[model samples]
Target chain A: MSGPDPERFDAFDARLKKAREQRQEAPERGAVDRSGMGTGLQAGIDVVAGVIGGLLIGWALDRWLGTSPVLLVVFLFLGAAAGTRNAFRTLQRLMEEGDRR
Target chain B: MASPLDQFIIKPIIPIEIAGADLSFTNSALWMAISVAAIYTLVMLGTRQAALVPGRLQSVVELSYEFVASMIRDNAGREGMKYFPIIFSLFMFILFGNMLGMIPGSFTFTSHIIVTFFMAACVFVTVTVIGFMKHGLHFLTLFTPPGAPKAIWPLLVPVEILSYCVRPISLSVRLFCNMLAGLTMMKVFATFAVALGIFGFAPLLIIIALTGLKILVAFLQAYIFTVLTCVYLHDSLHLH
Candidate 1:
């Protein structure tokens, strides 16, 4: 078969380029971007869970060892520290993810 | 008006007690079974044709597969592909569970801490086991943070270990609380919409917005849960 007309081929190529540009410029509607609220909620929960986990461990150890409130007090602080660390790490990861996006 | 929390109450459908153990199939269990059945049907429908050019159902299946596959590659690296089956199953299960729960009267099993905790705990155990298996005794070195002064080892080590232990708790609580809070808030707003009568339009509008938000939250929570699991897997697979 004879080659297609040059003018029509050029027009089609330009149209295809424009469509590709538009697709690249616009965000993908199907893939929802991570929201600030979701990230914030996650960070907050991470901190809280860290604290809770530490407290539980401390409380259990204290009860088992019959140390009364001494170990409990120490663990409460350690748990808070751990929780803060986790929250800090979460925020850091969020920043890294944002950079990647 | 029924209490907003009433939606969470588990009532036994088929109560079976054996030797003082309560083996009851409740509404929660029923919904879980329904979710599983719905997922199975969708996957079966999507894959049965196996067309070269995918139809609508096949497109959905392919899209989800690509989504989780990319998510795994991005978060967990190439080696993590081995665990794709478990990760994909977890994602689909939670996604379906959350979406189904959005139905007006469906049970949200994910809202329960026990269910989420069990899943999270399993992931934690698996990841830990994999780390130990791969690295042997070297896995213990994971607790020692990189570039820390040797002097503060005592303080930092405990903190690091505690934070590591915090993974499962954080994972489970994040999902459970989101579902619990979203559902409760919607139920409360729904009650207001009913009680307001002539001025019900206010809460009615809020409920509409909240409904949309809850749907987004449901999907987001599932995505985050899977992503975090991948992250944890990545950490175990490659230290630091």
Candidate 2:
């Protein structure tokens, strides 16, 4: 393989280096890089955390409603709905952004 | 009424009980087949008419291909491009499964631990095996930070090991629980919206909002899964 174009390489490197110098707050860059392991891991953490948190809320609601399995069952379904909804929105966003290009 | 979570209960068309386990053709499995058919039809029709300027069909197909390609490129780099087939298939499957599950009485496979666990475990095992295949037992060194003090090795190593072990569990539970909760909530609220018998829109509006949110969750969850796969591949290749 010949390797990436030198000009493109220089442009890419320059943007990254410049972004780093600016402390990563540009439109093309950000403080948080959602590029690798961290993004996915963080998402996993968030989802797990959200579910547990939601369960607590749901369980409490169940108690308030004077229903045993009701809240647990209802909120579990709600949580799944929320998760799937988020995933669909993300897909549309990605595709839309891709279309913009 | 029919149990708040009755919708999520995947009844099988062909109830096949071999010995003990409930191995039946569940609603989830049915929807999965439908999703696959949809994909097949879309791909076939989209690719059938190849044009230079590109029609709507061609554009849809091409854009999807490029979208996934760019995602893999950005996250997994050029080397990981080879896994595009697996990654794209996964993205589509999860995406379809999620969206279809949102259609009122449909079953969300991702809401099941067995399904999500299987998917996450595939990523975990694939990456681990890939890491070893690429870097040998040296991949174990991934647990140790690059510039950490030797004193912290014992502490960090065990923590890292535990975190790694929990990977599949976390991934599986997160998807499963989220779907389970969302579907059940929708059902309960819908029941209330109807049973209110007097003032209805209150629960109706809430469930509508929740359903909308569920659609967002579906895409986000799939993206999360795919990104994590890319990250794992990245770690396997880069070892950091």
Candidate closest to the true structure, highest TM-score: 1
Could you list the CA RMSD of all candidates, in the order they appear?
2.3, 12.2
Name model 1 segments beyond 4 Å from true: A1-30
Q: Residue B61 in candidate 1 has what lDDT?
A: 90
The iRMS of model 2 comes to 11.4
lDDT of all predictions, in order shown? Answer: 0.91, 0.73
Summarize candidate 2's per-residue lDDT along B145-192 as a digit string, tens digits. 679899988755644544454456556666677678878888888889
- C-alpha lDDT of candidate 1 relative to the true structure: 0.91
lDDT per residue (tens digit) for residues B1-240 in model 1: 799999999999999999999989999999999988987898899999999999999999999999999989988999999999999999999999899999998899999999999999999999999899989989989999999999999999999999999899999999999999999999998899899898999999999999999999899889989999999999999988
Tens digits of per-residue lDDT for model 2, A2-101: 8778998899999999989887554453112234443454454544534453466578878898887787775555554444333343345445545544
What does candidate 2 score on TM?
Answer: 0.70
